[model samples]
Target: MSAEIAPQPLLQVNNIEVVYDHVILVLKGVSLQVNHGSIVALLGANGAGKSTTLKAISNLLRAERGDVTKGSITFEGRQIGKSDAPQLVRRGIIQVMEGRRCFEHLSVEEDLMTGAYTRRDGRAAIKQDLEMVFNYFPRLTTRKSTKTGYISGGEQQMVAIGRALMARPKLMLLDEPSMGLAPQLVEEIFQIIVRLNREENVSILLAEQNVNRALKVADFAYILENGRVVLDGDAETIRKNEDVREFYLGLTEIGKKSYRDVKHYRRRKRWLA
Candidate 1:
């Protein structure tokens, strides 16, 4: 007998409209899909409903104040829009929310254990998973017993991502993972995400403002503007699109070529000098 093939499309978000108080519409009609073992990016500026879309998928929408008014979110071929956040975790869909929401009072290791609250695995397996996280983020292991509030921001971000991993998710919703990090640290975090996608085969739906970096890593990308998906295509195609460059990239027709030529000129000037 042959080994069974894993199912495709770990998560799918189709035409989701999120509204606040039945008056304000944040996401007009956002549709996105993430295949198994691929990295996808949702690129948009602030207030573009990127985070709201993530909340809708994770079923963390504030029901009394905000909610998904229409459309469906499916995880592993099952509808999950109405499911609660904890139920989503049990379904192997987890979100590493924006702002690196860590338990400041809890120790690093303790915080990670919170993710395993729904796990039915044995304690020994949980322990081994903890060690695996330690290997991926060595700093977390060094500060395992330290309170999360005392750790550096980069370390805290690692703790947040590690905590999500502890749940053994098939798909991760990463909201602004590069937010508030130093330039070097942002690069470091992106590399780690790439590694996670490749090594663990974990699908990722990344909401990011750092287009230059996010497009480099994502296989597919969607560009949202004012609550609508204005552009959707393969990463490389979007990267090279003239319209995307002019509008979203903040570079005009001639401006795009000027950037390239300027770099060439600087390199030549250095060689001559």
Candidate 2:
């Protein structure tokens, strides 16, 4: 009998360090991988270098005066050294930023159309993609004519994701898609994300603060603290970890505690030793 071959990663970040404005060192020896057709979560508190990691992969750090000072990043078997962000997008890697950025003045449909800028496909294909985005986010169809700024926060978030979808990405770098939305909306978005992963076969690298939700949807996960990867494992293993349960999930044998208190308690975890 023949042995099974392990598949290569769709994206790889190896021991990368990021620095800002030539002085502020941010990411410290961060490394992770996203395999084809899988959802990998990057979990951390605010300022934990989650977003910076995504930027490093997409090569967006240059615009922010940040540079990868060490290590390497590879995508689809090619090294991405000093690659341009737009070129990355053209290569089917797209990033949906943290804030759900939208063109306030542009109509909802127009905002989505911007995602297709890199494509050389015809108008018919673009129209088909627009309908596909609307199918995933039915609310966007209803607000197609509205100015993006006039829509609800949840709707704005949908627009952001829909816009990224318009790019026809093979790999999506999603940063904090759950932030600032209602619990229901967050769940809704994550369901759609899972559908996109399973149904559309798109690979995902997600940076998220909502540990519980992210773990539920992700295949593999990495936990970051103070700009470094402190722990990582398969989702089930991570969820069962005592420290993760206490610090991130806000769950303990006793009850849920404030995250502020949890942050202080994390210093004593064996993983940090």
Best by lDDT: 2
Among all windows of 10 consecutive residues in model 1, the one with the lowest summed lDDT is 1-10
| C-alpha lDDT (0 to 100) for residue 214 of candidate 1 | 93
Q: Per-candidate RMSD vs. true structure?
A: 8.1, 3.0
Candidate 2 Cα deviation (angstroms), residue 148? 0.4
Displacement of the residue 216 alpha carbon in candidate 2, Å: 0.6
What's the C-alpha lDDT at position 102 in model 1? 95
**Which regions of candidate 2 are displaced past 4 Å?**
1-6, 254-265, 268-273
TM-score of each: 0.88, 0.93
lDDT of 1 at 195: 91
Model 1 clashing residue pairs (backbone): none
Assess candidate 2 and give its TM-score to the true structure: 0.93
lDDT of 1 by residue, 167-252 (tens): 99989999999999999989888989989888887789999998888999998899887777878888999999876665567766
